[model samples]
Target: MISKVIAILLYLAVVMYLGYKGWKTTQRPTDYMLAGRRMSPWVMALSYGATFVSTSAIVGFGGAAGLFGFPLLWLTFLTIFVGVFIAMVGFGKRTRRMGLSLNSHTFPELLGRRYRSSFIQRFAGGIIFLFIPIYAAAVLIGISRILEISLGVPYEAALVFMTLLLAAYVITGGLKAVMYTDAFQALIMGMMMLMLLGGTYYMLGGVTEAHSTLASMAHLMPSKLQLGGMEGWTQGARFGTPLWLVIYTTIVYGVGIGVLAQPQLAVRFMTVHSDRELNRAVLVGGIFIPIMTGVAFTVGALSNAVFMEKFGKISIAMAAGNMDKIIPLYIEKIMPPWFAGLFLLGMFAAAMSTLSSQYHVGGTSLSRDIWENIKGREASVAASRFGVAATVLAALIWAWVLPPSVIARATAFFFGLCAASFLPAYLLGLYWKRMTKGAAVISMVGGFATSMFWLLFVHLKEAKVIGLSKALFGVDSLASLAPKGSAMWLMQWVDPNVIALPVAMLLAVGAAYATQTMQREHVELCFENIR
Candidate 1:
C-alpha cells in the first residue's frame, strides 16, 4: 500500500509540473494549438504513440485477444505501418507544411482553409464535438473498471476522479500540456508492458514451451465461440466464419484503417517544425507502438495458459465470462501488490493521456471551429476551457449511463465515422490540386450519412444497442435475410468501414472529375509550402 501510494503521488507530481510548464509557456493560440510548432521529435513521437494506444488497446482489444486470439497482432502491425509510418511520412510532412502555410491550427481548420469553406470547418467540428464523447466515455469505462476490480475503488468515483484530474490540466494548458504529459505517460506505459511481457513468459515456462502448450489446448475453445467459427485461443478463428469476419473486418480493418482519418492523431503532425522531425519520429514510434500493442495482444492470448496453470481453468471461465475483467484479474493474480500498484498507475496514465487529447480536440472543435467560424465570434482560450468542461460532463454522463462492452465498439464507431467522413477530403485536399470544394462537401456529407445509416440500421449489434431498429423497424437489423449458420446469413457482421470507406473514396474521385476545377490561384496556394 505504501509503495503504491508513493508511486501514485510521484506520478501526479510530475504530471502537475508538466502541466504548469505548459500553462506558463502558452501565450497565443499558436502555442496552445500546435505547441508553437517547435516540439521535439521524441515528444511528438511518444505523444502520438501514447495517444494512439490507450485503455482502448490495453483493456478493450486486449480483452478481445483474450477471447479471439493472436490475429489481433495484425492490427498491431497496421497501427505501426499505416497509423504511424504512412501517416507520418505520407501525410505528416505535407500536413505540417500545409498547416503552417494556411495558418491553420486544428484539423477542421486545416480543411476549412484548404477549401476556403467555413462550412467545412463548422461541419467537421460539429461532428467531432458530437461523437467524441462516446469514444471518451469508452476510455473512462476502461480505467474505471480496472480501478473498481483491482484497487477496490467505486467505478463512479474513479470516473469522477479521472475526469477532474484530466480537466484540470487540459483546461489550464491545452494541447501543449496534453502532449507533454502524453510523452511521460508513454514512457511509464512502455516500461510496464515490457515488465508484463517478461513476467508473462517467465510464468509460462520458456517462450516456445508456453506457446506450444497454448496451441495444444485448441480444443478447449468455448462452445459459444466454436459455434461462431473460432478454432482456438492460439490459432485464431477459421477463415470465413462469422467470428472470423468480425475479428478481421470490424476489429482489425475498422480500427486500423480508421487511424488514417483520426483528428486527434492527425493534429499531432502539425505540432512539429519540419519533415526531418517526422522522419526521426518513425523509429521511436515503431518501437513504442509494438511494445504497447504487440505486447498487449501477445500477453492477452497467452493469459489462458497462465490461468490454466495456476487456477486449473481457462481465462474466460476464471473471469466469469466478463472479458473486461480478464486482464485486471490476471494482473492481480500474477503480480505482487506493489507491482500491481505500479501497473495501475501505468493504466491511469494511459487512460488520462488519451482522454486529455480527446477532450482537448473536442473542446477546440466546439470553441475554435464551430463557435468562432459558424457563429461569427472570435475564438478565445476561455471559450475553449468552457468547451473542455462541457466535453467532460458529456463523457461522464455516457460512462455512467451506458451498459458494459461499449469500450471497443465505441472506439470502432468513431474511427469508422472519421474514415467515412474525413479521409476522402483530407487525402485529396493534400495531394490533388484540382479537387474542388463541392466534391469535398459531397464526399464528407455522403460518407457521413452512409456510415451513420449503416450503424443505425445495418450493424445489428449497434442497432440493437442504440434501440433504433427495434423501435422503428421491429427487427434487429434492416437486412435480416440470412440464415444464422450460413456465411451470407449474418453478412452485416462486417464493419461499415469495409463498405463506407470505399464508397467515400469513389465519390471523391468521381465527384471531383464531374465538378468545376479549382481556380488557378487556389491550386497554386494549395501547393505553395510543399513546392
Candidate 2:
C-alpha cells in the first residue's frame, strides 16, 4: 500500500509540474486555448493519441474486446488509417490554415466564421456542452473502478478525487496544460500497455499459444451472446445477428468515421504551427495509436483465456456480469502487486488526460463559443476557467448517478452525435467553397435531430433507459414493430451515426446547391493563406 501510494504521488507530481509549465507560458487567449498554435510535432502527436485513445478505449472498448474478441481490431485499423493519417493529411493542414484565416480559436468558432453566423457557433458549442459530460463521466467511471479495486478507495470518492485533480490543472492552464500533461500521460500509457501485453503472453506461455487457446474456446460463448449473434470470443458474431450489428456498426463504424468529426480532436489540428508538424505527427501517431488501442484489444480478449485457465471462469463471469470490471479484475488477479500499482497509474493517466480535454473543450464551448459570442462579450480566460469548474461538476454528477454500463455507450453516443452533427458542416466547410450559411445550419440541425431521434426512439440503451418507447409507443425500440427478427430489427442494433451522418452530408450538399453560395473571393480567401 505504501509503495502504491508512493507510485501514485510520483505520477501526480509529474503531471502537476507539466501543469505549472503550461500556466507560466500561457499569455493570451490563443495560448490558453491553443498553446499559441506553435506546439511541436511530438507533443501534438502524442497529445492527440492520448486524448483520442482514453479509458473509453482501454476500459470500455477493451472490455468489449473480451466479450466480442479480435474483431475489434478493425477499429484499430480505422484509428491508424482514417483517424490519424487521413484526418491529418486530408484535413489537418486545411483546418489549421483556414482557422488562422478566420481567426477562429474554437471549433465552434471555426464553423461559425465559415458560415458567418453566431448561431452556428453557439449551436455547435451548445451540442458539445450538453453531450460531452456524459462521455467525460464514462472516462471518470473507468479510472474510478480501477482505483476502487487497486487502492481500496470507494468508487464515488475516487471519482470525485480524480475529477478534482483534472479540474485543478485544466482550469488553471487550459489547453496548454491539457496537451503537455497529455504528452506525459501518453508515455505512461504506452509503457504500461506494452508491459501488459508482454505479461499476458508470458502468462499464457507465448503469443501464438495464447491466441490458439482463446480460439479453441469458441464453443464456450455465453448463451446470451450466442442468441444475440455472437459466434465466439475468438470468431466474433455471425453475420445478420444482433450482436454483429452492435459490434460492426455501433462500435466499429460509429467510432471509426466519427473520429473525423470530433471537435476536441479536430481542434488539436489548429494547435500546431504548420502542415510539416502534422506530417511529422502522422508518423508518431501511426505508431503510438496502435500501441495504445491494439494492445488493449489483444490483452482484453486473451484475458478470458488467462482467467479461465487459472480460475476456471471467463473474464466477464469473473467480473460478475459486468464487462466494465473485466480489465481491472484482470490486472489485480494476474499481474504482480507492483505492476498493478504501475498500471493503475497508467489507467489514471489515460482517464485524466482524456477527461481534462473533454472538460476543457466543454468549458470553452460554453464560455468562448456560446456565452461570450451570443452576448457580444470579449473572450475571457477567466470565463473559461469558471466554465471548466461547472463542467467538472456536471461530469461528477453524471458519473455518480449513471450505471457502469454507460461508460461505453456514452462514449459511442457522443461520438455518433458529433459525427452526425458536425461531419458534414466541417467537411464541406473545409473542402467546398459553395457551402452556404443556410446549408450549414440545416445540415447541423437535421443531423442532430435525426441522431437524437434514433437514440431516444430506436437505440435500445437510451430507449430502455429513458423509457420513452415504452411510455409513449408501447415498444422497446422505434423498430420493435418492424417485422420482428428481420433486417429492419437488425438495423435497430445499428448506431444512429450510420443513418445520421449520411443525412447530414446530403442535407449539406443539397442545401448548399439550393441556396446562394459564398462569394468566389471569399472562397479563395478561405484557403489563400494556406499556399
Candidate 3:
C-alpha cells in the first residue's frame, strides 16, 4: 500500500511538472487552445492517440469485449485504418490547413468560420458542452472502477478525487497542459498494455494455445447471450441477431465511423504546424492505436478463458453481470499483485489523458464557441478556466447518476451523436465549396434532433434507461410495439448512427443544392494554402 502511494505521488509529481511547463509557456489564446500551432509531431501523435483511446476504450470497451469476445477485434481494425490512418492522413491535413487559414481554435469554431455562421459554431458548441459530460462519465467510471478494485478506494471518493485532480491542471494550463500530459500518459499506457498482453498470454500458455482454449469454450456461453446471437469468444456473433446488431451497429460500426467527428480528436489536427507533421504523426498513431486497442480487446476476450479455467465461470459471470467491472476484476484476481498497482497507474493515465482533453474541449466550447459568440466578443481566459471547472463538476455528477455497465454504451452514444450531428457538415465543409451555410445549419440541427429522438424513443438501450418512451407510450422503445420476432422489433438494437448518419448526409447534400453557395472569397480563404 505504501509503495503504491509512493508510485502514485511520483507519477503525479511528473504530471504536475508538465502541467506547470504548459502554464508557463501559454502566453496567448492560441497557446492555450492550439499550443501555438507548433507542437512536435511525436507529442501530437501520442497526445492524439492517448486522448482518442481513453479508459473507456481500455476498461469500458475492453470489458464489453469480455462479453462479446473476438468480434470486438473488428473495432481495432477501424481504430487503425479509419481512426488513425484516414483521420490523420485524409482529414488531418485538410482540417489543419483550414483551421490555420480561418484561425479557428475549436471544432465548432472551425465550422462556424468556414461557413461564416456564428449560429453554427454556437449550436455545435452547445451540443458538445451538454452531451460531452455523459461521455466523460464513461471514462470516469472506468478509472474509478480500477481504483475501487485495485486500491480498495471507495468509488464515490475516487470519482471526486479524480475530478478535482484533473480540474487542477486542465482548468489552469489549457490544451498545452492536456497534450503534454497526454503524451506522458500515452507512454505509460503503451508499456502497461504490452505487459498486460504478454502476461495474459503467458498465464494461459502461448498465443495459439490461448486462442484455441478460448475457442473450445464456445458451448460455455451464457444461454442469454447465445439467445441474443452470440456464438462464442473465438467465433463471431451470429449474423443479423440482436447481439449482432448491438455489436456491429453500436459498438463496431457506430464508434468506428463516429470517431471521425469527435470534437476532441478533431481539434488535435489544429495543434500541429503543417501537413508534414500530420503525415509523420500518422505512422506513430497507426502503431500506437493498434497496440492500445488490440491488446485491450484480446486480453478482454482471453480473460473469459482464464476466468473459466480458474473460477469455473465466464468473465461477465465473475463480474456479477456488471461489464464495467470485468477488466478490473480480472486484473485483481488473475494478474500478479504488483501488476495491480502498475495497471492502476496506467488506467489513471488513460482516464486523465482523455478526460483532460474532454474537459478542455468542453470548456472552450462554452467560453470560446458559445458564450463569446453570445456576448459578441472574445471570452477572457478566466472565463474559460471557470468553464473547465463547470465541465468537471457536470461530469462528476453524471458519473454518480449513471448506471453500472453503462460505460461502453454511454461512449457509443456520445460518439454516434457527434458523428450524426457534426460529420455531414464538417466533412463537406472541408472539401466542397458548394456546401452552404444554410445546409450546414440544417444538417447539424437535423442530425442532432434525429439522433436524440432515436435515443429517447427507439434505441432500446437508452430508451429503457431513460424511460421517456415508456412514459410517453408505455413501451421501453417504440420498436417494442412491433410484433415479437418481427423485422421492426430489430430496430431497437440498431445504433442511431446506422440510421442517422445517412439521413444527415442526405440532408447535407439536399440542403446544399437547395441553398445558395457561400461567397467565393470566403470559400477561397478556407481552401488557401492547401496542397
Candidate 4:
C-alpha cells in the first residue's frame, strides 16, 4: 500500500514538474499553439504515437480484444502504415509548408485559410466540438475504470483525479507541455509494455508451451486455430459482415488515413524545424506504434494461456476480455509490489498522455475554432486557458455518469464521426484538385448524416429486437423494417465508418464537381496554399 502511494505521488510530481518546465518556456500563442515550430521530429513522433494510444486503446480496446478475439490485430499494422506513413508521404511536407506560409495557428485556421473560407473553419470546428468530447470522455472513463478496478479508488474520485492532473499541465504549458510530457510518457509506456510482455511470456512458459497448452483447452484457441484460425476471413465474413466490416474497415483504415489531415497532427508537421525532422519522425513513429500496439494485441491474446495455466478460470476484464489485462494482471502476479506499482504507472502514463492531447485539441477547437469564429480573432490567451479548463471539467463530469454500455463505444463513435465529417473533405482538400467548396460541404454533410443515421436507427441494439432465438434478439423501431436478430441475421453491416465514410467521399466529389464552375475566393485560396 505504501509503495502504491509512493508510486502515485512520485508520478504526480514528475508529471507536474514536466508541465512546470514547459510552462516556463512558453510565452505567447505561437509557443502554446505550435511549440514555436521547432520541435524535433523524434519528439513529434513520440507525442503523436503517445497521443493516439490512449486509455481507450489500453482499456476499451483491451476489453474489445478480449470480447472480439484476434482479428482486430489488423489495427496494429494499419496504425503504423496509414497513421504514420500517409501522414509523412501524403500530407506532412505540404501541410508544414502551407501552414508556415499562412501563419495559421490551428487546424481549422489552416483549412480555412487554405480554402479561404471561414465557412470551412466554422464547419470543421462545429464537428470537432460536437464529437471530440465524446472521445475525450471515453479516455477519462477508461482511466477512471482502471483506477476503480486496480486501486479500488472511487469512480468519481478517479475521474476527478484524472481531470485535475491533465488540466494542470495543459492549462499551464499548452502544446509544448503536451508534447514534452507525451514523449516522456511514451518512453515509460514503451518500457512498461515491454516489461508486461516479457513477464506474461515468462510466466506462461513461452510461446510453444502456451500454444500447446491452449491447444488442449476448450475455446482457448478459436475453432479454426489451425486453419490460420480467425486470422483468415472469419472477421470480414462473420464478425465483420456488412455492418461491422464497414465499422472495422473505416475505423482501421479510414480513421488511420484521416490522421494525415488532422488539425492537431497537421500542426506538428508545420511546427518541426525541418523536412529532415519529419523524415526522422517517420522512423520513430513507425517503429514505436507497432511495438506498443502489437504488445496490446499479443498480450491480450496470451492472457488466455496465462489464466488457464494459473487459476483454471477465465478473467480477462483487465485486458477488457481476451488478455488486455494480461499486462496489468501479470504485473500484479509476477512483479514485486514496488515494481507492480511502477508497471501500473504505465497505465497512468497512457491515460494522461492521450487525454492531455484530446483535452488540448478539443479546448483549442473550442477557444480557437468556436470562440474565434463567433467572437472573431484576438481572443485572449486567458480565454484559451479558460476554455481548456472548462472543456476538461465538462468531459470529466460527463465521463462519471455515462451509461456503462456507452463508455466503451464513445471513442469508436468519435473516430467514426471524425471519419465521416472530416476525412472526406480533409483528404480531398489535400490531394484532389477537383475538390470544391460545395463538394467538401456535401461530403461532410453526407458522411456526418449517414454515420449518425447508421448509429442511431439502423445499427443500434434496438434494431436487434427480433432474433434467431426469440428471447435473444431485440427489435428496432425507427427503420424502414423493424429489424431484429442476434447480429448474425441483420444490422451486421452497421459499422458507421465503412458505410458513412464512403458515402461522404462520394458526395464530396460529386458536390465539388456539381458546383465546379462556381469558384469562390475561399476555395481558390486553399489551392494556392499548397501550390
Best by lDDT: 3
lDDT-superior candidate, 1 or 3:
3
Reference-based lDDT, residue 347, model 3: 92
RMSD of each: 1.2, 1.0, 0.8, 4.5
User: All candidates' TM-scores?
Assistant: 0.98, 0.99, 0.99, 0.87
Q: Residue 147, candidate 1: how far off, in angstroms?
A: 1.2
Candidate 3 structure quality by residue, lDDT tens digits, 41-120? 99999999999999999999999999999999999999999999888887899999999899999999999999999999
When summed lDDT is taken over every stretch of 10 residues in candidate 2, the lowest stretch is: 403-412
Instruction: List lDDT for all candidates, in order.
Output: 0.89, 0.91, 0.93, 0.69
Worst lDDT run of 10 residues, candidate 1, spans: 481-490
Residue-level lDDT of model 4, residues 1-531, one tens digit each, is 777778889887988888988899888878887888998788899998898887677666655554344555778777887778887767787777667767778887777766666787787877776567677887787767667656878879988888887898898798899998899889988887787678767777886776455445444434433222233212322553443454365445545555554555666787797778889999998988887877776665556556656666544533343333444454465456776776668878888888888777777777887788888866566777887887787787668766664544666667767778777776777777667767776777778888776766565442343232223333342432443444443444355676788788889877876875435554455457565
The segments of candidate 2 whose C-alpha lies over 4 angstroms from its true place after superposition are none
The model with the greater TM-score, 2 or 4, is 2
Q: Residues 38-107, candidate 2: write the lDDT tens digits.
A: 9989999999999999998999999988899999999999999989998999989999999999989999
lDDT of 1: 0.89
Give RMSD (Å) of candidate 4 vs. truth: 4.5
